[model samples]
Every structure is written in C-alpha cells, then in structure tokens.
Target chain A: MIRAVLALARSDLFRWHRSPALVAATLIPALSMGVMVVALTYAVGRQPVALVIEDHGPVADHIIQIIRESDGFFLVERTREEALADMKAQRVAAVITIPAGFEDRVGSHDAKLDVFINNVDLDFSDDVRRSINEAVVEVDAPSLATLGENDLPPGTVSGIPNPYRIDVAERDLRTPDVSFLAYQMVPVLALLSLTAGALVTALAIAGEREVGALRLVRLSPVPRTAVVAGRLLGGTVASGALLSAVVLAATLTDVLSPPAGRWPLLMLLLLVTAVGSVGLGVLVGLLTRRVTTTAMLGVNVATASFLLGGGFTTIAFLPDFVQGVARAFPTYYAVEGVREVLFYDSMPTLGRNLAALTATAVVSLVVGSVALARVSARPH
Target chain B: MSSWWRAFDGGLRTQLRSFLRTPMTAFLVLILPINLLLLLSLFALTGYNAPTALVMGEDTAAARSYVEALEDTHNSFELRPMDLATAQDQLKRARLVAILEIPPGFEAGVQAGHTVPVNLTLDNVNLDMAEDVRRAVPAAAVIFAARNAFPEVRIEADLRNLLPRDTGYVQYLGVSAVALAACIAGAVLGGTVTAREWELGTARLSQLAPGGAAAVLAGRLAAAAVAGVVASSVTALIVWFGYSVHPVHPLEVGLTLVATVFACTMLGGLVGAGLRRVMPVAPLLIGTLLPFYLDSGALEPQRFDGEWLFALAHLSPTYYSVGVMEHAYHGLVVTPEPRWLLLLALVAIGLASLAALPRVARR
Candidate 1:
C-alpha cells in the first residue's frame, strides 16, 4: 500500500510539473491578492488634498502646518489658482483654504475656515470631514488646555477662554503600529494555501477521470485508500511549496518579519491546512470530473473557504453567527493559527488548531477514499 | 455578405443557447460576482464603524456629555462602554482599536471654567483603523465644545460639497460592481466559449466555414459581449433594487455598461484565443479581478490613493470603467479626465484586444 501510494503521488507530481497551465490556474488567485496588498496599502489613510494658503500670515502658516501634520491628508504645494484647477479637475480630494483676513476673523472670534471638498462618496468624504474637524479645532486646543490647566492663573493665555473647554489627550496602547497591508497579507497567504491545495488536487483528479486513468487505477491492484492518499500527498506538497516560496519572497524583501524561530511553526500549520483542503479537493475532483467544471468549482470552493474563514478580519470579533459559521471551516483555524505563529510566540489555540486540522485531514481522506471506491464500483 | 451574416447568426445563436444550458458558465458569470457583492455589502453595512471602548472614570455631566458627543461622530467608532481595566486589556490584546478614558475629573474642572482633558488610549496595531480613532476623538471633542454653547472663540468649517448629497459607500461599491460583473461575464462567457471551441476542436470547424474563422470569432466575441450585457443587467438590477442605488442617468448607465462589457468580453476573448484552454482562462481573469478592482478605484478615486498607485491605476481598464460608471450612476465625475475620453478608452481597449487576436487563424 505504501509503495502504491508513493508511486501514485510521484506520478501526479510529475504530471503537475509538466502541465504549467494547470498549476498556473491554481496559483492565480493568491498571487493576485499578493499584488492587491500593495494597492490597498496606498488606498487607506492617505488622501491627497490641495491646501491653498490665501493668507500668508503666521496663523495661516500654522493652519498649513496642522494640515501637513495630519496623517490622513497628503498636502501638495499649489497656488490658489493651481489648487482651484486641481479641485475643478478632481485631481485632489479636497481644497482647504486659509482665506484672506483669516487671522482678523480669528481675533474677532467670527472665523469659519473654508473647506471645498469633493465629497464624492461617504468613504472619501468621511475621512476628509473627520480630519478637517480635527484640524480646525486643533488651533484652540493647546490654548484651551494651557489656560484650563493653570490653577489660579490669569483668565487667559494668548486670549483663548476656558468656557466649556474640553480636549483629547491621546495615549497609544501599542508602541509600533502594524501596517494595514502587512496585517491583511496574513489572510492573503492563508488564502493561497487554501486555493492551491484544493485547486491543484481537484484539477489533477479531474484530469485523471477525464482521460480514463481512474478506471485503470481501479482495475490495478492499488487500494482506493492508496490512491486518495497519493492525491493528498501531491496536493499538500504542491501547496506547501507555493506557501514556502511566497513566505520566502516576503521575508527576503523585508515585507514580512516574523519573529525568529516561528518559520517552522508557520510551515507546519499551513501544510496541515493544505492537507485538509486537498482532501476536500479530492472529493471535489470526484464530484466534478470534467476539467472545465472542476476548475470553476475549485476556484469557487476555495473562495468560499477563504471568505467563510474570517476574511480580512478576526473571526472572534465577528458577529456570533458568523463566527459560528467560520468555526465549521478548517481554513478559519488555519488563518487564526498562522496569525498566532507570526505575531505571538505563545499561541493559546495552537493545540486546538493542530487538532482540528488533523481531524479534518483524517475525515477528508476517509470520505474521499470511500467516495472514490463507490464511484469506481459504479458502471462506466 | 449573406454568408458572413449566416455564420455570425449561427455563432450567436449557438453560444446563447449553449450558455443558457451551461450551469457552470451561469455560476461564474452571474452567481459568483453577485455572491461577492452580497458578502462585501454585508461588510460595508457596518458603515465602516470601527469598534472602540469607552471607559468612563467620572460619572459627571461633563463625562456623559462627552460620551454623547462621541456617539454623534460620523460613523467613525462603534463605542462600547467598558471599565478602564477591561478596555485597557482589550486594547493590549488587539481586540479593541482604542479606549477613550474619561478620567476622574468629576466635572469640577468644567465648573471652574477650565479645560479638562479626556484621555484616549489607542492600540495602534493597524494605523488605518487607529487614525480613524485618532481623528474621531478630536472631532468628537469639537462637538463637545459646540454642544456646551460656549461663549468663547470658536471656529467652524464653512464646507462646500461638490455633490449635492453624499453618496453612500454601498451605493458606490455596488455600482462599480456592475463593471466588475461585466469583467467576470466577459472572461467567463466570452473567454470560455472561445477556449471551448479549441478544446473541443471546433476551431477547425470554424476554419472550414464560410467567411473563415474570423467571422465566427467576431460573432462569438459579439455574442459574448451581448451575453455579458444580459448577465450584468441582472447585477445592475440587484444593485438598483437590492442595494437601492438608482441610476441618475439611466440611459447613460446602460450605455456605460454596454461599453464596458463590450470591451471586457473582447479582452477576455483575446486571452481565450491566446491561452486556448478553458481551465486556465476563467481562473486567470477571475483571480486578477482583485488587483484590477483596487487599481481602478472601485471604492474611491485613485488620485487620493497617492501618486505611485494613481499612476498604476491608468494601466487597468477598470479605471476607465468605474470613472464613466460613477458619473452615469451617481452623476459624480470621479475622474479628472474627460468622461467621453474615458469611455473612448474602454472602447479602444476592446477594439485593440479584438485586433490583436488572430481573427482569421491563418494556420
């Protein structure tokens, strides 16, 4: 049985090596998401705005500095006419102007900073709205805090009153901020494992059925268990190889700096995930024998797995029902497991993830082999 | 000309009938993108409200009022009332994005006519969510000041919006998803039929027919675009009725989709001709859709995404597709380029891809 399984696995790997198109089909989705992280990195937290300084006074300069310091807005130096042109052309998200006589209005307490925003959609406008609200109030924030904090001092310093005075004093709980792109890349990598494992196995099995090779295997002395075991072996190895390459690339480029000594754990978790997914793939292959159907459904199944497995966010944080659904899928454990290995050395759920994935693999292999035997026993 | 028409008619009729019978094709063209739309819309339904914890150390009127102001913030934070210890613990564990601590001021400072500071402890795990918290706090503070009706010097924003009203996030993404539907339909509908022809040796059959392979390819390409239109219409209706995003210029919206679908199907057909296999073509196009969606500014205009990313946006046809689609659906000109020019670019993409594929199959 061992010899038969090894031979079958070797043959499948050889065929996959020869069929570049089949392999390409499997890797595409995860690769595309890898490309997507770069774009997503830029899409969030940096919106370009044209800051037109109509007043070159010190106060106006102060406002400019505030806008410049804002994390959300990317300010470019442009003249008023230039800014207007950019705004009219939709070249910038918004045009914030420190209008002429702005300091005079501030002195008289009748100032309203002008903001002409291209509030195209709530997603874009909300960022600008919140930032602008913060920027405008920031001018009075320091004075208010200083005057209010002084005990029995003069009524005002730099002449800002303390009536109804309230300000925000921020205390960050974490030292270094994680880039959204890097955090999201973790999910993307798990998705790659899920896609490659299921897709590659499904296509290989589909190919075998399409060309009548499965009938030959059934006629031979090889046990059904050997054949299914072979399929899982080939699929897990392929997926593991892809996962290794991606992790290597990411680490080499300094994109992913997982803590030292975590690579082996990461490798183990992802490979086990691939094993479980490939078992499902074997069943998928048996169900859809045609290459066309198998290819389409393989992508679909993997996608469904990725989505149900806590896509782009934490499963524990999701609504209870959604989390319940996520727990039913193995990829969920894989995603959570990978995050643990990468971010924290001591993962509380590491044992649970390993147990769940191992059980899934065992169940899938048994079911897949039984299904294969049933199908082979049927009339041609 | 009559033979050409006959061949074209045959190819069109064949694909349409074939597509209706093919459940797999239907699943890819219509069901997949629709499922994505539904799943994604569910996420957006949270209205981008990030979860944060509020720890009220003081039970005074000032603290309560400040909490009220935080609630009034523009869908920025979903405030969860928690004790300071619990909030700090969640923040450390990365479960909560931030914790707003209303320290034990007791409103005494407010009664003394002094400014009191509310501390905000942020996890800052991901700067994207953290910054939203960072900005929302001060914005909330400003509101806190305004509600007090303070007689002190206060500056407000005199805002001028380009649009008459703010377009909702779902409304925008749902509309752009129609263009996405077009892409899926084009690749699956058009690409598959073309690849299936070669996979089943129908390429030779077309080669032997009247007007040669080119006429059949053209017919199939046209039929694919037409199929894409029908498939995407279902998506559009769902976006309209399901998501309630009625088009501002209904006729123009239809035309924009037609143009986008037409272009996409042709490109898909081009890829099909080159790859010549149904297995690789569908997954390839579907797989790449994510990057294409992001690059094309499906969620927001690319200019705001930064210079390098914006420059890369020009490489995707989706950039042009969403540009015209947004204008047609919401009357919002999202692109700096002329709308007509953008539409023209989509058409050119279709024509150019069609031109590149071997229409005649000379070999």
Candidate 2:
C-alpha cells in the first residue's frame, strides 16, 4: 500500500514539471500575502507626526527629547501653518503643539499639550492616544515607561523612582518582543499552506475528473485508498516545497526566529497543516469534479477558514461562539500549533492541536478513497 | 455607427445572460465577493477588543476607579474580573492578551504619597498588541492621576481631533472591502467573459463581426461592470446593515462604486485577454486582491506607510477606490487629487485597459 501510494504521489509531483502554471497558481496567494505582510509593517508602526514646539523652555525641550526618544511616532519639526496644512491635507497623522508656558506652569504642575490628531480609525487613533498618554506619563514617571531598559537619562538618577502617586509597569510574558508582522506571519503561513495544498490537490484531481480519469484510477491494481493517500502525500509535498522556500527566506533574513531547536517541530506542524489541507482538497475535488469550480471554491474555503482561524488577530480576541467555531477547523489548530512551536518553550498545549490536525488528514483521505471507489468503473 | 451599437448591445446582453445562465460566473461575481466581505466583516466584529483579565488584588476606591479608567479606554481591552492563577493559565494558553493586576498595595500606595505600581502581566506574542496594552496602561494612568488630582503628574494632554469622530476599524475595513468586491467582480467576471470567446473559439467570430472586437469588448466590459456594481452594492449594503457603516455621501459612494467596478472590469478584461484562459484568471485575481488592498489606502492612506509603498499604492486601482470610498463613507480625504479627478482617472484606467484588450485579443 505504501509503495503504491508513493508511486501515485511521485507521479503527481513529477507531473508539475510539464505544467509550470500549476506551480505558479499555488504560490500566488502565498506570495501576495508576503507582500501584504510587508505593507502591514508600514501600517502598524512609526506613524508620521508634526511637532510644533511653541514653548522654547527647558521643560518643553525635555518633553520634545522624550517624544523623540519614544517609540512608534515618526516625529518631525513643522511650523504651525505647515502642521495645520499637513493635518488638513492628511499628510501627517497628528500635530503636537507645546503652548508658550515659559516654564512657570510646571511650578503649578498643570502644564498641558495641545495635540491635533486626525482620528481616521481606531487603529490609527488608538495608537496616537496611547502614545500621547505614554509620552505624558513619562514626564512624571520615566521609570515606568522604561520597564526593561537600563539606560539612564541625563536628568534622572538610575535607582531613583518618581514621586507620582500612581505608576504603570508592564512586564512582557516573553522576552524580546516579537514584531507584529512576524507574529501575523505565522497564521498567513497556515493560510498559505492550506490554500496552496488544497488548491493544488483539488485542481489536479478535478482536472483529472473532468476527463473521467479519476474513475479510471479505481480500476487500477492498487487499493483505492492508496490512491487517495498518494494524492494527499503528493499535495503536501508539492506545497511543502513552496512553503519551505518562505520558511527558509524568513529564517535567513531573521523575519521569524522560533525557539531554540524548534525548527523541526515547526516544519512538522506545517506538514501536518498541508496534509490536512490536501486531504480536504481530495474531498472537494471528488465532490466538485470540475477544475474551475474546485479552484474557485478552494480559494474561498481557504480564505474563510484562514480568517476564522485568526489570520490577522488572536483567536482569544474572537467572540465565544466564533472561537468555538474556529477551534473546529484545522486552521485554528494550525495557527495555535505553529505558535506553540515558535513562541513557547514547554508546549504542553501542542498535543490536542496535533491530534486534531492528524485526524483531519486521516478522515479526509478515508472519505476521498470511499468516494473514489463508489464512482462507476468507466473510461473516458 | 449603428452596426457598432448593435454589436455592442448584443455583446452586453449575451454576457449578462451568461451570468444568469452560468453557475461559475454567478459564483465568481456575486456569491464570491459577498462571501469575502461577510467573512472579513465577521472577523473584524469579534477581533477588535483583546480579552484581558482584571485581577483586583485590593478592591478599594482607587482600584475600582482604576478599573473604570481601564474600561474607559474602550477600544483597547475587554477586561473580565478573574483570579490571578486562572488569568495566568489563560494567558499561557493564548486565551487572554494580558492580566492586569492591582497587586496588593495598589490602592493604599495610590491613596498615600508614595508611587504604587499596577502590574500588567502581558502576553507579548504580537508586538503591536503588546504596544496597545502597554500604551493603554499609561493612558489609564493619565486618567487615574487626573481624577485623583495627583500633583506630581504635571503635564497632561488636551487632544483635539481633526475629524469630527473616529471611524471604527471594522467600519473602515468594511468600506474598503466594498472596493475589494469591485476588484474581484472586475477581474473574474470581466476576464472570464472576455476570455470565454477565446476559450470557446468565439474570438474569431468577434473578429469577423462588422463592429470589430472593440464593440464586443465594450459590451462585455459594460455587462461585467454592471455585475461588478451588483456585487459591490450587496457588499456596501452588508457593510451598512451588518456593521452599521452608513455611507455619509450616498451619491459619491454610488458613483465611486460604479466607476471603480467599471475600471476593474476593464482591467480584468485585459488580464483575461492577456492570459486567454478562464482557469487561472479567477485565482490570480483573488490571490492578488489582498496585497492590493493592503498597499492601497484600505488600512490607512497608503502614503502614510511610506513614500516608496505609497508609490506602489498608485499601481493598484483599489488605491483610487480607497480614496473615493474613504471620502464617501468616512468623510475623510486620503488623496490630494479631487474626488472628481480621481473618478475620472478610474474611468480613464478602464478605457485604457479596454483599448488594450483588443491588442491582446488579436493573439
């Protein structure tokens, strides 16, 4: 059975050499997502803001220095006229202004900064709000903002704490903060694997079915189950080859850094995801039996499942019922499973997701084979 | 002239009837685009607020006020009261974004003159999320100090929004997805209809017709554009009723959606004629949509990303679509060009692509 499956798989894999468009079709979505990820890095970080410092006092200078030192805001000096014009034109996200206080207001401890922000959306607005709030707090409590940073500023003593009544200290669960782009890259890979594996396998099978080749396979000496198994293996290997390039590029460029010795586990999770996806392809291909329909449906199903399984956001962030629904799909497991191997050290949570993924692969292959056997023994 | 009109009318009617008769084209144009919007909007609905745990170690006036402050930053976190252990466990398993602890001495220290730290144990898996959490804590602190009249907290913010109100992320994305719908409709319907001639060997017939391929191409594009309009309207309605994203400028929204769809259909026609295959067009269009939307002003003004990326953004029809949609939906101008100019540009793009289709069709 294994040998038969291998032969079937090998034939399917080698057939791509005659048809390069098939390979290109499989990689398009994944490559486009890579481009989107690059675009997201621009969207989420370092927004451009114009700073108009009306007050030339020492405190204003200090705050200006803090704003410059702070993360996430792309600050530039702009005149009042230019800043307002830029804000009206949507050239900058926000305009920060310091009133001409003459440093006397600080003695009363009631200084205020006037900021004009273009509140387009919560994602952009919230970043500005949080950042402004952070900048304000750092004036009174710099230590709180610098939770991990050991560098001492010119004015403040290293050991000395601020005299504020309230302070906020945020401790990360993991060291070395992972980039949002990198974290999102995990689910996108799952999306790619699912899309590529399923789309390729389904298209191949459906193409064959169009010419009545699938029913012909049933007349072969090999067990029908082996043929389905071979399809699954072939799809996984083909997509695995393409996704492997992404994984390799990401690793080489330091776009993704999994935990030490976790590369094998990560690859295993990807293979499992592809297998499950390919299995699903077999089912879709068998059911549809049309190349175009399979291709269209494959893209839609993969996208929907990818989003439900937390492509852009955390599954925890999803509603209770939606989260429950997400858990039922292999994509949910694929994402969480990959994150387990990538982010966490212990990974006690990996077992359930792994089991679910493996079950998906097995069930799809079995169902596909059964359907293949049920088809009439005929030739085109 | 009359013959051209006849051929154009005939081409339009035939393709329009195909959408009704053919399952694949209907699925490609109407069902697929709507499904895309629904899935994305649904994801947006549940995915905004991070699920967090609020562990009140000492539930005093200060702690309770702190909770209120945390809650006031409405868009950031959805805090639920729980024990530290449960929160930690959930955080470890990726169920919670963070655990906010008012560690035993919080209220007392806050009531007193000494500084009291509110510990936020965060799952910093995604740095953007971690930044939001980190920033929210300080945001809450600003509220905390102001409410308590903490003297040492000197500087404060007097924020003035340039826009009247901030549009929610879901609404923004939903509106953007309307343009995405147009893009899909254009590519799939436009391409498939144009490519159908070649695939079914009718390109020869169109070539032999009195009006030549131009009239046939226009007829096909117009039919697809109407289908594209139908697809985007359904999406816009979904965005309206489903997500409460009411278009501020109804006339402009309608105009933009129609024009953008028309442009996209022409582009799709170009792609279809260029590829000359029905099989690859749908997947290619669907696959490329994400990057187009991402680089376009769908998330924000593409120019905000950077100059280089902004330059790339103009390459996408969705960028112009975004400018028009952002204005019509949210009442914000993302592009320097006038909306009328942008709309004209979109129409020009469609015409250019339509003109280019015949050249590809000859092959």
Candidate closest to the true structure, highest TM-score: 2
Mark the regions of model 1 whose C-alpha exceeds 4 Å error after superposition: A137-164, A167-173, A259-265, A307-310, A313-328, A344-356, A376-379, B42-47, B58-60, B83-95, B104-106, B151-156, B306-308, B359-363
What TM-score does prediction 2 earn?
0.94
DockQ of 1: 0.55
Candidate 1 residue pairs in backbone clash? none
DockQ of 2: 0.58
Could you give the fnat of all candidates in order? 0.69, 0.70
List model 1 lDDT by residue over A215-293, tens digit each: 7766877777777677778888888888889889888877677778887888888788888878888888888888878
Model 2 clash pairs? none
TM-score of chain B of 1: 0.89
My TM-score estimates for the predictions, one after another, are: 0.91, 0.94
Q: What lDDT score is found at residue B181 in candidate 2?
A: 85
Tens-digit lDDT track of model 1 for B1-363: 588887888888877787677766466566666766665564454445677888877788878888888887777888889898888666655467777777787488776777776666666655667777767776776777778766674576777888788988888888888878777777676777788888888988887878777777788788788878887888888988887888888887788889888888888887787778888987798887768887787888877776677788787777888898888888888788998899899899888888878852442
